[model samples]
Structure formats: C-alpha cells, structure tokens
Target: MIEYVARSGPPEAMNCPAFICDTCRNQVVAEGIVTWATTIGRDGDRGPHQQTPVYVAHKGRCGRGLELWIEQHYPAADGWIDLWDDLEDFVCQLTHNLTNAFADDTEGTYHPHRLVHPKERR
Candidate 1:
C-alpha cells in the first residue's frame, strides 16, 4: 500500500481510474480482483476498523488497457493508493458505529481482505 502511494502519487483513490497491482506493481487499468486481509489493530484495541486498499492483478496475472477505463468503485480507507476496490464502503461498514466488514474479515478469505484488491503492494 505504502509502496503504491509512494510510487503512484495521488489526490485520492476512490472513483479514480486505477490502482497498482501488488503482483506486478503496475497500474490495474481496468476491473481487477478484490479480496480481503487480516490485521491486528495497531493499538490492539481493534484499531477502530481497518485502513486502506492494497492492489494486485487478477489471477496472479497482469492486465493492460488505456489505464483510464474503470473508475474506482471505492476509496482507499486512509487516502493513498488503491488496492481495495470497495475500500471506502468497507471501512465505513467496519469503522462506522463500530460495525464490522465481514466480521472484521480476520477469518475466511482474509487478506483485512483478498479484497485489498489481496495484499498491500510492496
């Protein structure tokens, strides 16, 4: 995630054109895969919900396009790059009112997502 942000420079990720693919470290030019991950809250107090989306190419494979087709359906939880396709909504569900995104998604298909678009890039 940090790598993507550091490399990709951004105003925000939500509805943006694309994000970095963790596997290939390139821009996901169009629709890509989304998964989940698990992380221990920073303060060990459930961290007040998860943060940020990590991106990767779909099926362990890379993709190509004009790099301006898919508008981000969600925002990076903390504002940086995108790996989470639905990060904004996911974070909201989890942090808002102390709700949980797929039960904190700590278990099953966890990545806080396979949906961090699966893991934080770099």
Candidate 2:
C-alpha cells in the first residue's frame, strides 16, 4: 500500500521534491494547504472510467474545479479528501464549468510537519 503523510518538507538531512499545483502551476509550499487522491475518472469524452489523477492542489480557488467535479459526480458526499500529486506528468483534468466547491477551507487547520526519515528517527 502506498501510504502518505501530509508534510511540507522532507526528512532531516535530505530533500524531497515538492508538488507543483495543477491549477495554479505554482509550488505548493508550507503556507499552502494541499490535498490529493488517486481517484477514478474518465478516459476521455464518455470514455471508460479509469483510475485517474492524484489531485494535488490548494484548498480554495486553485481547487475550485475539483470541488465541482466531485459534487456533480458524488453529490451525497459531504467533502473531499486531497492526495499527492508528485507525478511529473498528470493525466486527469479538473473541470470548472460546474458550481463552486464548498470545500472546508483547510488552511491553518492542520499542522504541516517535516517528515522524519525512517532511519533518522533513532
């Protein structure tokens, strides 16, 4: 299982890459709250539903499209959970034509931590 921990920086001594936001096309730094998921999506226009994007984005304006996408597809759900988007080439698309996403603004809600390398946690 691919497990993930939400943190802004890599473990001590070494550096891990940061994910560039698909919406803003900017670096999702510490002050910015990010969310991602490896969810199911379409292949194309009316295409077969395939496991699609790792939704990496901030919780507000940059994530508007994803919010709408979820509401149209899964209305019963109360909110969305974000996931990693470390992939160099992200395939899935987030549509913004629908209504706005009432995403619970996640900024400043959680503490962003520095991931401790497993070996370094002695």
Best by lDDT: 2
Report each candidate's C-alpha RMSD, comma-separated, in the order given: 13.6, 16.5
Q: Judging by TM-score against the true structure, name the best candidate.
A: 2
Residue-by-residue lDDT tens digits, candidate 2, 26-49: 666543433333222323223222
| Candidate 1 worst ten-residue window by lDDT | 63-72
Instruction: Give the 10-residue window scoring lowest on summed lDDT in candidate 2.
Output: 42-51
Q: List candidate 1 stretches off by more than 4 Å.
A: 1-18, 39-53, 59-122
lDDT of candidate 1 over 1-120, digit per residue (tens): 223243334664444334566556666543565443333343354333443343345433342221111123233343323234343454355467475455566655432322333234
- What's the CA RMSD of model 2 in angstroms? 16.5
